[model samples]
Target chain A: MSLLEFLDYSGVAVFAATGALAASRKELDLIGFLFLAAVTGIGGGTLRDLILGQAPVFWVMRPTYVVVCVAMGVLVFFTAHLFESRYRLLVWLDAIGLSAYCVMGAAKGLAATASPTVAIVTGTMTAAFGGILRDILANEPSVLLRPEIYVTAALSGAALFTLSSEMGAPLWLASLAGAILAFGVRGGALAFGWTFPPYKARPGRHPDDVM
Target chain B: MSLLEFLDYSGVAVFAATGALAASRKELDLIGFLFLAAVTGIGGGTLRDLILGQAPVFWVMRPTYVVVCVAMGVLVFFTAHLFESRYRLLVWLDAIGLSAYCVMGAAKGLAATASPTVAIVTGTMTAAFGGILRDILANEPSVLLRPEIYVTAALSGAALFTLSSEMGAPLWLASLAGAILAFGVRGGALAFGWTFPPYKARPGRHPDDVM
Candidate 1:
């Protein structure tokens, strides 16, 4: 529980930073920057809770997550230049955030008394959804249908986490292993240009063929 | 059933047109335009279906909706100028579309095994979510959470439709009444500056206020 809490706060801080970085590119106001940060920081968990039919949502219930985001927002508002150089650092931090949230989401699902498969899928969704939403809000493409291996890495980590838990592993070990695996897979994908292939269908009279 | 089909198709076309207007403003490519149109036309339905746990979603089950979005995309591609003035036209067309879809969604929910309350909420949600998605995609503020009475109008229409149906009213009469009610309410709000008051929570200090 201690580790989970630490990771949740840390993940939120990193996501908030990246979100601030992303928003800076849009040249929006301070409110927009903070809104982006808040959305990216807790967006995944909120979506997961909503889909699970949970009430109040995590951020709404605890409300600390919003504070964390706002704090980061204030920091970014003043120190935005700290993030201007070397976008590579942002990517690594994002991967770490994703890994943390992946394990957290799985743990949340398990706590919710869902089945293993449901837990695994839910965890992956929790990890991936924040970035997807961030991309959408940033006016970039939604990452859901993108070719990237983002979802796959989260899925891999979540599967391993669920499997370990089913095999009687300790909760702490399960979470640690899942986070490491997710971080590694996403890191590898970033380094190696790994991606899912394009979706295919019958290639006939559709005008969409020209695209 | 025929009325349902008509409203459903009309909603698709009008929403697609609205999406095209958004995309044209951004000078999006064909892919982006088509994607935006699809999201605008079917986004509300997709959200409603997912929340209701409806499987295989309407577009996934029937490719025709995708085709319709693509076809509209092509039309917009060739004649973007014809829609140069569409935003003005769309204000009313969208109100009509909202009216049509609220009743459609309510009817679908009422027919399904869901509770009446859920049905009522789902119907309003179904009518409102498309524009919500469109604004999100267009990187504009969400109309749903705005001071505008967008969601309230949809709720009124949905209630009217559901109640009329339960009273054994004919489908046309119920749909017409619901449509007019929704349209009028939304129109009135637009004309008269109606708005939802902000949440009543006391204002807070900066950074601390977010929580």
Candidate 2:
């Protein structure tokens, strides 16, 4: 397989594992694990394809993606007891997936001749949307609501990739730069528990009181 | 406009209103109301179009849907306090939207020459996905997990529509039957608090304890 394709599959596998871990945490049934993993692995790509009007969403075109998710879910279900720190494992795996998926999404957008802004947005969405769906399915507040610098990292990677490609960088060079930048930011956050400032509450202020 | 076109627009308006109400309950700002409303209004149709490989998503192709959502958001933001029971309003509006969207989705699927089963599934998705998404964004537990017999109502309507179409029923007649069936079931659930049996607990039996 080409390097990009390899990276894509790796990202899918890691994301699926994280989703399965979430299902285990929720004490959901086996079907829940498989469903969550499958959606978490491909939800972002599916949304991006739909927005770009790409027919036959990527997973539908290649059922191997679903197979991978199912395998990951079953594997995680059996081996979860072996992992001492499931939360940490989920976070690290998510970081890896985020970086790779951002690059892939940007590449796909560029391949489709999307504008730079649209391409970057596509990349960010591809990286973050699966996790969002996973959290929703599990009835947890999404990481997006945690004041984390998560989507920002995906945005940076996507923007870098789109900009590099626009400036005539080779595909491999551009992807490498994007993935490294994304991983660096995400990995730093995971290592340091970094987060952005939460929204300040205005005491006794109603949202509609002013308007 | 045709009756179907009218019903589609009405459904969009009601769904958007319901979303806005949810934002109001969450005490979100104006932008939040608009965003949630737009998503709830188009989420179902977008999913249906994507799965069916219909390009440009319905709302993207016709900006009027978005305009309607925005208007509904602003209106609700201003008038939400006037409603004494916002939750009731949301449920009633959702039921109305569900019935209309199901018939519309089934028609769209049949127009695409999809199999009867696929058409029925599409219809159910189109009727239910928006509410699922809205609940997620609002951080409310989805009604789908409430054992409310919600999806079953949507499925019955879609199945009825597709079957009638296959039996040479006219468009208007088939759609009417489908809409009435969906609305009747959903409305009855609302009026009588009907629900399905929740999964019984298997005491002390772990999901992962087995193979």
Q: Which numbered prediction scores highest in TM-score against the true structure?
A: 2
Per-residue accuracy of model 2 over A1-211 as CA lDDT, tens digit each: 8767877887788899889888776665454566567668877888888777786667656657767987998888777756656667787888889998999888888788668988898899989998888877777668787655799889999999899989999888888899999999988887777787766668887655653
| CA lDDT scores, all candidates in order | 0.74, 0.82
Q: Which ten residues in a row have the lowest lDDT in candidate 1 chain B?
A: B81-90
The digit string of per-residue lDDT tens for model 1 on B1-211 reads 4877887777787777667656655555555566567668877776777667664356544556656876876677666554335455556666777887888788788877546687689889889888877777667556666576888888999899889888889988888788789988998877786777756655554534644
Give lDDT tens digits, candidate 1, residues A120-145: 75687678767768888887665444
- Highest-lDDT candidate: 2
Q: Flag clash pairs in model 1.
A: none
| Residue B179 alpha-carbon offset, candidate 2, angstroms | 15
